[model samples]
Target: MTAKTLFEKIWDAHVVAAESTDTPAILYVDLHLVHEVTSPQAFTELRERGLKLRRPERMLATLDHSTPTLPTAANGERPYANDEAKAQVAQLESNCREFGVALHGWDSADRGIVHVIGPELGVTQPGMTIVCGDSHTSTHGAFGALAFGIGTTEVGHVMATQCLLQRRPKTLAIHVDGQLPQGVGAKDLILHIIGQIGVDGGTGHVIEYRGPAIAALSMEQRMTVCNMSIEAGARAGLIAPDETTFAWLQGRPQAPQGAAWDAAVARWRRLPTDAGARFDREVRIDATAVKPTVTYGTHPGMAIAMDAPVPPARNAQEKRALEYMQSQPGQPMQGMPVDVVFIGSCTNSRLSDLREAANVLRGRRVASRVRMLVVPGSEAVRRDAEREGLHQVFTAAGAEWRVPGCSMCIAMNGDLAQPGQLVVSTSNRNFEGRQGKGARTVLASPATAAASAVAGSIADPRDYLVEVAA
Candidate 1:
């Protein structure tokens, strides 16, 4: 066995003890979060097996994807175009009540995206193991926790046992150095890394984000970086919990308090990889080299600098991806027309992201042909933004400021792109039909999305920010 990195050490600590290579190992899960889209089947399985949730207090449910974006009236009925979506939300509510799991539904102010709510509500903490049905569960790993997505069957296992039989994944250290360039954000950095490594490069591994650049990022920015680790096929992505992480956790509902809080922070401060710790694989990226990035093809890896033209892909897979995206090699990403722009998701829906987009949209109107929407990750974020007057800036610029939900990031709810429309979005994934059937999605930073919305094409935010600053 190789010398373990911090991820390995953490995973080893969480293992309750292994059975055999084929047999599942009972790994402890500190947190379990469920959402409407993936929990109904698992809940049904639980009912069939006559198994109750092992730890009701450790698990929480929220209605996000299936809940309608429309505001509810005093009668409590939402304006949902699809009854089945509402039915899923109802099912989740019922299952959580039946299993004694805490739920944040449409009526709850705390409700939002599962990943978003976890960290915001203090349910996600350092040195914990968190699992959810959604792939973006890596979002919690930003707090230096072991977090990953589980399939429905695994969700059922967690619901019943509060443990997972998990295979320990190898560790990969991704070192990012130097300060990022102006207008470059964590979304740009991750997209650039994914472009360099290809989407499948980190399969069967856990990635530990390190180096000066990673250290310099705020907790929300780190969350954005880890959130897309799943897109690169990593089991999880983490940063060692530091002062920033501890500061973010202080006073949160689920975090430790009093003597326990100090003790927990002391433990978390020691969670970093020991000096000379070895990783199975390592990759280094110079943050200064990353520019405002945009995806040209369906996969997150199929990206290039906003100012640069797409490079020719000599391989068959590259050629196919280019063809599917209707993108030509050597074509510049700049000046490419877009029909829609979205600035929200688990990846970039935090208050900082909204503030950045608002900064770009202030005193400028959105392009006449471009339709823009800003969806806060959670109800709390929506309320916070409105309190800070971010919503006014967005609406004044002709961008729709909708209720909190996973609006157009995924088609789970009623909001989605029209068929064949191209969108510049801040969401993590750009997989085929990820936004909607036949909708072309280009992943970009919130600033870039705002710039694109103003220009009606793929434009770099640096251009606008410089002009506005001057």
Candidate 2:
């Protein structure tokens, strides 16, 4: 028998029907994640067609995007961005009730950003096929799941029949050797990867991040890496299940228990790519060379080491990105003034991420000229951070500690950057107007974001880390 890649193994198992050159394969979906913003339209389609969800138990819904990160008013009314946002939430509740789907409502302690809550609840597991309307759904791929985002129409299709028609994406293996320097982490690693390969380099492929460096990363760090695979144009990102993966899922609310867990781990252990399995393509990176990195332009690919000068654009599109960002080819990023610093998103809002940022902010103060917001990824993360007194650190440092939600990541919520402001954000994308109209976004890791908040500029996180250690 031929050795099979991890993706091939999962894809083959979930295929209800094989694909041909001109036809797509019918693949079974193990989980469907729903959020208020994109799910209403999909549910509407289901209602119009008189269709009920085929597998309600396999779905989990939450309210995120467009939900204000701020708490309710004194009158106890949620300060939704607008009536449409409020309506979307209500519509989701109605649809979930009508379809018999489970929803983590605002009052639920489990409610959070869809991607964050999925793994937190242990609903995302190895070898499972997961889909959601939001692109960052690939975050679940950190656990070896075959996860990807879908469109509203496809969401409706999955609701009607717990299956999807998909063409298998070719596999791209990214191998990283050596150790990442202190203060540089998963977010920087991914940004560096995107910089090396253009934003579209992973087009038409699924990326499997492997090697010693990848294996050394924690589960949350791996999630941060996979969460941005979409920005690389990959259908999904995956890491084979290992001891670390199993350990993270062992006792979660939805994870299997007792003998069942043993059996599940046994199964997952077999899911890694078979030795000598061939990939369609491969890219190798020396992790030692990676540094605290940040995006200087309007896209994820236009990034450089935090200590390095911005590179010159090679094309018209590149020039436009620089112009939009108000950046020049030889400009130094280190001391560029930052108007705001936001550290939260599915990509890097986990507890560990908050702790890392807090480490940099402890006994420090946000610059008088800079405003900073730190939003947790979920209710659980918020609770955990408060328990650890991380929130106190943030607030003491003069940063706003926000409620759990997508927050400024989507910019549709009440949390947004003012026009013409320069933002150092921990979110995945730095696209034009992503945070607000005329806002310039610089993508960085949590540590870097916190450091920038202190320095009022794009500063190296290592400076703060060294001080913290001392």
Candidate 3:
């Protein structure tokens, strides 16, 4: 076997010994976050088996995927009127209560998207193993943890044993060099990389994001980068813990306290790859070459610079994706008309993202022909943005500022794009019908989305940003 990379070392450390080559390996899971969509079936399985959660204290449950932005304003009103959704949330609450797992539900100030709540609450620390039922659980990897999504069955496995059987994945070091140009954000950078690597280039591997450009991103930006690792066909994405990670951890509820904090930081400082560590694969990207980007086809990788013409469908896969997206090649992404603009999701719904969108939209009105929506990733983010008047900016721009949840990103709830409607979105993933059936979605940065919302068409933020700065 080759000398292990940091990801492999971390994985081996978490392994509680293997069962068999085909059977599951018992790998300790430091944190388990349960959400409504994936927990119901797992809970059902547990009830059927007469098994309780092995260690409830290590698990946290919340309702997000199925919760609506509105709850009836009456006595005993539930936020979700869908009976199945209500049951899922109710079951999760019951499971957590009966098994003593902590829960943050609709009324709880701590409630939000599981991925969003974990890091904000300090439950996702560096050098930890975190798993959730949601695929974007990789978002927590921003803290330098081995975080990834699991299936419902695997969710049960984690609940029953606080361990999972996972195959050791190859490691790919994605070295992003140089500083990102002005107006380019993490979303743009990841999109640019995906465009270069193709969506499935990192299959069967875990990606370690490294180098000056990757290290320069803020915690939220790092989350945005790692959140889309799965789109690149990586099992997970990680960054080595550093001062930026520690600064974000301090003072949070689950973060270490007093001297414990100092000790934890000291340990985190040592989490980087040791000298001479080896990776199975490597890719390099120049951040300075990346510009504002948008997806023109169904896949995230089928993207180009905002000002560039759409690429021709050169192959079978490209042709299929292009046909599904109904996009013509060689057409400029900019000035492409849109019907809806969405700014939220686990990928780019943090407070800073909201602030950036707000800064771009301030004193500007969204086009009357376009409908815009802003959904905060979590309740805490929603509250903070409102306190800072970010909501006001969105609303003033004729955008609907909804409550916290993964609205429109996965379409689990009522928020979805209408058929044939083109949407300019900040959320990751623009795959076929990702927003809704026949609804075209173009992934862009928050600034780009804001600019598009105002212009009623795809437009670069640099165009408006320069004028505003001037």
Candidate 4:
């Protein structure tokens, strides 16, 4: 066989049928994750067509987008305050029960963000095609799975067939060199990449994030890197599964058992880009050059150094972004007052992320002027954090430690920063109105978010870490 890129290898492995180069190929899905917001329409379509799910066992459903961070009742059973939000959650429950598909509702110990639970449950694995009705589905690629988001119609298509007709995406390889400097993390690394490539630089491509720096990151960190691939306009992003990947999966609930696991590992080892493999485009970045980064504009690409002044608006978009953020060009955001700090999202809400943030907040307190939230990504994450005393650290620091869900990352629910307020978040997108109406959001790492919560501004984590160290 000819040498092939990792993306080609994974895509080909799942191709059930193909006719011509121009037509979409039938790619079998190994995992189908659904959520309340998008899956409702897909399920309704299935019902209207009088179609039963082809494979209920292959599908998983969860409630996150509309679940409230503040539970309305004890025992973690909370109905969304908004009737529409409550209906979405209730509809998903009814659909899953009727379809015989398993659901990880807010009541489930396994519940949280769809992307967060997949890997934790041992369901997300290498050499598999995974699809979700949410854009951040690219997050699963950290396990070496070929995962991406699908629309409502496509969601219905997969439910009935467990297959998708997809045209092959061009491959782009991004290589990183050396070690990341202290205080720099996967969030900073990806934000820098977006800034360099521009928002559309990755259009029509499936990005393979490779090289030493990528290989060095833990599975959680790798997930953070892959989570934002869509922000770069790529269909998905993946890393070849290795020891770090295998170690994280070995004992998860859905992982292959014993001998089956060994065989899976052997195949995953060979799935890396073959020597002399070709790519449509390539980018290289030095890990040392990355710094603690934060977005100053509405888009993820409009980022500058955490302590530096917002760059002079170079385009109309940046100009408008500056106006929305209510900041002047060339003014440092370091001491700029922050009204809120959000330190959770699929992008950086994993245990490692929480640990890093907790490390910064251990002996410190949230600034009196700022409202801070440290939401876990999943129920399992929340439970583990509580056991590890992470929850106490966050709460003791004057931050609200909330239940797991996609809280404040999107304003689908009511967990949003107030209009016109400046929010420093650990979520992926920082677009205008993403957090709430007229809300200005700056994206950063969990540690950065924690630091800003302490300083009441967009403070740098390195300085705070040093303070804690001292």
Q: Can you write out model 2's per-residue Cα lDDT over 294-377, one digit (the tens) per residue?
A: 999988988899778889888998889988888878877888899999999999899999999999999999999999999999
Worst 10 residues of 1 by lDDT: 1-10
> Which residue pairs in model 2 clash with each other?
none
Worst 10 residues of 3 by lDDT: 1-10
Question: Where is model 2 more than 4 Å wrong at Cα?
Answer: none
43-159 per-residue lDDT for model 4 (tens digits): 888899999999999998998899888866776556575888888889999999999999998568999999999999999999889999888999999988889999999999999
What lDDT is obtained when candidate 2 is compared to the true structure? 0.93
Scored by TM-score, the top model is 2
TM-score of every model versus the real structure: 0.97, 0.99, 0.96, 0.98
Per-candidate local distance difference test: 0.88, 0.93, 0.88, 0.90
lDDT of 1 by residue, 340-363 (tens): 999988899999999999999999
**Order of candidates by lDDT, top first?**
2, 4, 1, 3
Query: Is 2 or 4 the stronger prediction by lDDT?
Result: 2
Question: Model 3, which residues run further than 4 Å from truth?
Answer: 1-4, 18-24, 74-81
